[model samples]
Structure formats: C-alpha cells, structure tokens
Target: MSTTTSETGARVVPIPPPLYYAAALVGGVLLDRVFPLAAAHPALRVAGLVIACAGAGSAAAGVLAVIRHRTTIVPHRPVATLITTGVYRVSRNPMYLGLALLVPGLGLLIGTWWPLVLLPLTLLAVTRLVIAPEERYLRQRFPDEYDAYRARVRRWL
Candidate 1:
C-alpha cells in the first residue's frame, strides 16, 4: 500500500536522509572553498581524499543494494518487495548510512572539522524525524516478515 500526504492526498514523501547529509556536505565544501583551512596540510588532504572515497563507496554499495533488490530506494514508500540480502543484511537504511558517511567525508575534504563533528547530529535528526517513523510504518504494514528482518539486521550498520 502506498502512503499519502494528509492534506494534499499526495503520496507521503519520505525525505531521504542523504539529502540532509548531502546538503551538509555541500555546505562544508563551500565553506572549505571560501575558507581554505586544510589547504596547508598535506596529511589532511590525504585523509580527506580517503574519507571522500569511503563515502562514495558506501553510497555506491547502497545503490547496488537498491538495484539488486529491484526496489525503489525512496525513504517514504519503500517497494513492496522486502530485501534481505547484500547490503540490506548489514543495515536497513544503508542509503542513509552511506549519506551519513558522506557528510563527514565532505567535511574532511573541505577541512571543516566542525561540520564533520555535526554529522552525527544530522543522522540523529533524520533517524528521529524520518527513519523511526518509517520503521514503525513498515512494522505495521509488513508485520511478521518485517519483524523477522528487523530482528536479524541492524537499523544502521
């Protein structure tokens, strides 16, 4: 069953957690470009590249998971098929996790330590405002099957 927005009757849109993470990442990038704090350190540059690569890798893995499941990765209305293999086995919200990873990577790339530190708060907000509710809905919608999957896998990995 599809979800709907109350007033508009539009399908309830689940905001992907990556959006916020990406926003933060972009912001961090801009800040770094404008501020240029990490440019002086060769080690920091290497670290930033590593972090950025890791973030890209995580996002790619999530995308592969979505394709493998043959499901829409939209946060609000997940596909009817329940995915339990590949990256889904590790994290119920790998896309979110990947985005989570991405923010800090961007921050590192930008040499903004504060933004990197803020990444956890961003994840917490997405989890509380979006992911948790989605989990509750999925629980109600799929019941036993979702519960089994939930039991076996972590919400974030």
Candidate 2:
C-alpha cells in the first residue's frame, strides 16, 4: 500500500525502515571513507557496540510485541490492533528509534564524525517521510485508543 496526500496528490515516501537504516549506514560509511578521521578510543568503540546491540534488541522487542498482539509489523500495512505494552509503553516508535540509535552507534564504532553530523538529518527524514504518515494513519484508524496511547507514551525515548 501507498500513502498519498489527499489535497495535493503528492506521494508520501514508502521507503521501509530497513532501507532507511541501510541508506544512513552507507552514507556514513562513504563519508568516513572519503575523509578518514582518527579512530575513536577503544572504550568509545565498545560503548558504540553496546548501544548498537541495545538498539537491535529494542527493535526485536517491538517486533515481538507486534507479533504477539497479532498485528502487522509493516508500517504501510493495516494495523490490526493498538499495541501499548512492552516497548510500546515507553516509545511509540521504538523501531524507528532503534534505527535512529544505530546511526550514532555505527558512526562511533567507525570513528567517524560524519554520521553524528548526519544523525539529525536522517531522523528528520524518517520523522517526516515515515513516522508522520504512520501516526496519521493510526490516529485515523484507532482514534480514541491511539489518542490515549499517544498521551501516555513518548514518541521516542
């Protein structure tokens, strides 16, 4: 399924989260490769690895929650239920948050400043191009339940 603006008929980006993560990872790698920088301290590299692992864990938890709830994990697909437990209790967009966290973690691991610089831009793109549309759809579909959930949980933690 595709997302489109009713008023302008403009197409909303339907890029999947994995693709976004890949793009950000590739962009950061390329930037670092072209302009090599001093490697981060070993401690920092370890910290980055931990953060990346945490992100992957979080994303997995989110997916598991969705599965347990019998809902589609695909953002563009129809949501079967409003999930508010587990990771969803803390962050409305844990998967997106996970992907966002990976940027800095990977950057730090690679000892490149470029990924840190591009983090905000990557987040902005995900927020505007992906999360916003999903939020709109969820609000429309779940209405009251979603409103309550939104009130209780932060978008990202």
Top model number, TM-score:
2
Candidate 2 similarity to native, TM-score: 0.88
Worst 10 residues of 1 by lDDT: 4-13
Per-residue CA lDDT of model 1 for 11-105, tens digit only, reads 33456556778666666667666765453366766777787777677678878877876766665654656677777788887777777766666
Give Cα distance to truth, residue 37, candidate 1, Å.
Answer: 6.5
lDDT of each: 0.69, 0.78
Q: Pick out the ten consecutive residues of candidate 2 with the lowest summed lDDT.
A: 3-12
lDDT of 2: 0.78
- Pairs of residues clashing in candidate 2: none
- What does each candidate score in C-alpha RMSD? 4.2, 4.1
Residue-pair clashes per candidate, as listed? 0, 0
